[model samples]
Target: MGYVMQPSRPIDWIRNAIRYTRHSPKRLDVFKKCVKAEKIDSKALLCLDIPTRWNSTYKMLDRAQKIEKAFNAFDLAHPNYRNNLRDGVPKVTDWSYARKLRNLLELFKHKTNNASATKYVTVNMFYIEMMDIYTHIRNMKGIDPESRLMADAMQNKFDKYWGTNNKGLNYILYFAAILDPQSKLGVLSFGFACVFKAEKKERDQRGT
Candidate 1:
């Protein structure tokens, strides 16, 4: 019984932080500043059957399943809670994640790379989980020094990893996603000089 109580305080704190952060002006500013506009190539992503992305296929499935379960728990905990929700909510069960997990488990059992639809589903599941965590942190409130420090650290990491003009994680993923499978020269890398130009073009096109 005492063991059960251990998680309550932290969970409640996280929940309250999540709720309050969803409405903060700082959070909104961060969202507008950090959320990048890019295309996701689900079909192409499915083609890359890289097992190194995860320790093992079974591990990948297990992690993805846990993520799915976490999402489900959060969903049931807060129905109609769209304050910080996105396309990644409800963490669909028996879907891509599950299929990939099952495929991965099979792969581990058989040691085969012929898993046709395994790659994209697992990758998408990861992307979704990361997006949710990032969004949650972006919208979270920091009332204490520790929380504020943690928030700042997370924000800085996001900015460092994904907030570059040309060589950012976003740019890498975008280029990779849109790569021509047959072409070695068609894929373009964004230069710092062109990043602003592309951003402006995107904004103008979006009428934002």
Candidate 2:
């Protein structure tokens, strides 16, 4: 579960690298003015991520990516900027990775927001969302070698929580899917057939 435990490492490093710029009032004001000049529809200040919240991290990276050029400009124009950030600033690759990671995390952010909605019952969404997350992890695994590592870690955690043998794999999730009007027993049967290659009787027994 390296990925699950450390998904924010890179973002944390980037944040640390730019901590001075983010905290410096002079640099922040200059960065804000530069963003205004460019007419970029972004906040006037950089967002520091809250450690406990993933969505806040996403928002921080998203805003940082948008104002990357402004940060560069500020760095170049401000005297003693390099001295202030002695630990080294984020490079182009770091920013690029942040952008990619932000995109990758968008699905989770959206799902989290949707699940928190108060207007409707969210139980029906559990099955589909879990499947969607599973597929997304698989896709990430196939994307590239680096992503493969992250995906592998995530997959390990996913299986730990939802694998056939895991206690977290309750029958209610399957029953919920079967109860959905759009995807009834047909979808459930197909899914079970794929997951459990045993006889129909065995699968039914497990379900019951």
Candidate 3:
């Protein structure tokens, strides 16, 4: 007979929610919108009859409850795998990475009126697409006949596109454009310059 290990439970999600909001009210607001987003429901409402502070407090708690439930399922299946930061290095699992990407996309999509979301969506979509191509190349790296086909496919995808350039430095510029849309696409480019550069470096080394 094989020994069975009971699944590890994550810290209570609702409790963590309270902690997060208590630490930063603004974060609570941001996550409320994100929760509404994943549920595809109507946006939270504000009533003229209610005090603004009380309204926000209620909404924040309500959102915390919902988010707590939503994450419980995801966490159970994925186990919240994280690296030991004390080791001065970090590692991530595909499940967590996939969830991160999805959550960011949801956040961007929910910010319907924010130009930053549009810009980020475009840049991140591009980066994820590029990663897909890079992943294929990596998977085929050591195989002879199979490698040629994958390389050809990657070349076609990279050479045939025409937005933001393949240099990938534009991802930072895109994020900057999000923060400062008034610049005509140049003002805050430097702000995210480091972000794109580091992402580019990391992109090159990521495994399939």
Task: Choose the strongest candidate by TM-score.
Answer: 2
Candidate 1: worst-modelled 10 consecutive residues by lDDT: 40-49
Clashes of 2: 0
For all predicted structures, in order, the TM-scores are 0.25, 0.78, 0.21
Cα lDDT tens digits, model 2, 70-168, are 767766777566666654567787788889878877776887787788999877777677767777776786677777786767777777876666875
Query: What TM-score would candidate 3 get against the native?
Result: 0.21
Full-model lDDT for every candidate: 0.37, 0.70, 0.36
True-structure RMSD, every candidate? 19.3, 6.1, 17.9
Provide the lDDT at 20 for model 3.
38
lDDT of 3 by residue, 1-208 (tens): 0112111121122223244334455644554555554673545432111122222333433443334433333232323211211221112332233233233223223332233354444442333334344444444444455334434444444444522355644457345444544543343444336445644764687751
How big is the positional error of residue 138 in model 3, measured in Å on the Cα after superposition? 20
The top-ranked prediction according to lDDT is 2
